[model samples]
Target: MLANMGNEIYRKIEQVKLLPLYTATDLTYLDRLEDILVKNNVRFIEVTFRSDLAIEAIKKLSQSNELIVGAGTVRTQKEAKDAIENGAKFVVSPAVVPEVIEYCIEQDVPVFPGTATPGDIQRAMEYGIKVVKFFPADIYGGLKAINALSGPFYDVKFLPTGGINEENFMEYVQNDHIVAVGGSFIISESLIKKDDGETADKALKSLIDKINLQK
Candidate 1:
């Protein structure tokens, strides 16, 4: 039943097609940020554990039914448990951590482990994971790398993050193997730090427009 729940959450992510990576150091503007995301129709967000306030941010944001909150940059079973306890509906990690993956699966939470090579992808597949994160994508050859990896693992879908931005995100999203794109591009850290809701709103609207055009 937990596996089914994980699959359902994955489907929701695919439908939205954008996974905004958020890092919060202060909670002052979290509500405003949530408002911008909701107003733009974005349904999922990955609050990265890059900041000390990430778990707290997840706790606060997960309370809202308007968005599905997830924990990102998670690398341990302890972090996974804490994030989930605090209300994160899913977990994302920079690399494949067996313990973390096992914990998430046992708990039935969707997990996306990072992969940058065939070895990593194969390892994830061995663990029964169908979707994996392509990290530092730009440095690893970007879309070309993902396309190349697709040849051997055709059944696997990728969520390419790192160095992705508005100009190149569409290229990745258009690919058949891409489940969804993950990055800070849509709602950048700079924008958030400034509490610039207007700009963030415009960025998200533009992205939604682009996705609609593709459809």
Candidate 2:
């Protein structure tokens, strides 16, 4: 189902892809992005620990109590725990790490670890995970990579992150195997910096609307 996932993965993507960052600006930008995402019907948020005030931000977003939030760029187990502790509903990584992946599974916390090649996909498969993020997606051949993986790994679903954007967004998600996509392009740091909250929000709304458009 092209709904949120596993339909398991999508519950994971919202937490990861929606991980937007601030420009060389203040923390209040999140307020604007929040309004945009909420109005646009973007159901997921990727909250990575890489940001300056991640825990606090996670706490803040949690307060809104809307959208399925998750941690992104999760490299260590400690980060994963912190995100969950701060109210992340799931976790996502830029690449596959057996221990980290298993840690989520062990806690039954749901994870969307990254994969770029068949070997990486196999590693995810070894653990019996159904959904994975295709990272550095553009560099690794973008849709071609997904298309190739689908040949042997039919049951596996992907949330292609990294370079996904408006131009090619529909191109990827419209496919049978691509469950969703992740990227910062839809809601950018630049837009946040300019203090154009409404414009940014409208852009995000348009993107989400485009995704839900009928063929």
Candidate 3:
């Protein structure tokens, strides 16, 4: 049952192809963000645990049947437990935390832990995880690094996050090794903080259009 659930979520992630990494500082803008995502037909969102309101944001957004809400920047089992209890359908961490990964797998929630080096990917592979996040992708050699890593770990897939933007995100997304590209480029911090729904909507639509055009 748990493996089936994981496969289901993985299909959704692949279909979306773009995972919006969101950080909610103020609770008021979540509705606006959700509205924009739904309007643009975006089905997956990773609400990072970067703010005090993150748990509440996850709870509120996950209530919507239209979205698959996940928790990001999670670094511990306690945080993972909190996110799941509040309705996060998946869990993402900045680094591979054994406890968190073990906990998520035990609960049957999909977990995408961050990886930067071969050692990190090797560790994650030991847990039977195929898809992992290539964090700070830009600083860590971007697609070049992923290409290198893929040589040894041929079956591993990546969700490249950090430093991904409108200019280079497609480059990562186009790679077969990447499951989906994630970052704050589309739904930026400024846009969310200012509650600029129009800009946010346009950005998301534009990217979605680009992705569609690529196909």
Clash pairs, model 1 backbone: none
Cα lDDT for residue 139, candidate 3: 91
At residue 5, candidate 1 shows an lDDT of 69
TM-score of candidate 2 against the unseen true structure: 0.87
lDDT of 3 by residue, 8-66 (tens): 88887888899988888777888888888989888888999898888999999988677
RMSD of each: 1.3, 3.7, 1.4
lDDT of 2 by residue, 95-195 (tens): 99766776777677778788998899998888777788888889999988789899999988888877877788878767778767777777765776666
How many residue pairs clash in all the candidates, one count each? 0, 9, 0
TM-score list, all predictions: 0.96, 0.87, 0.96
Q: Which is superior by lDDT, 2 or 3?
A: 3
Please rank every candidate by lDDT, starting with the best: 1, 3, 2
Candidate 3's TM-score = 0.96
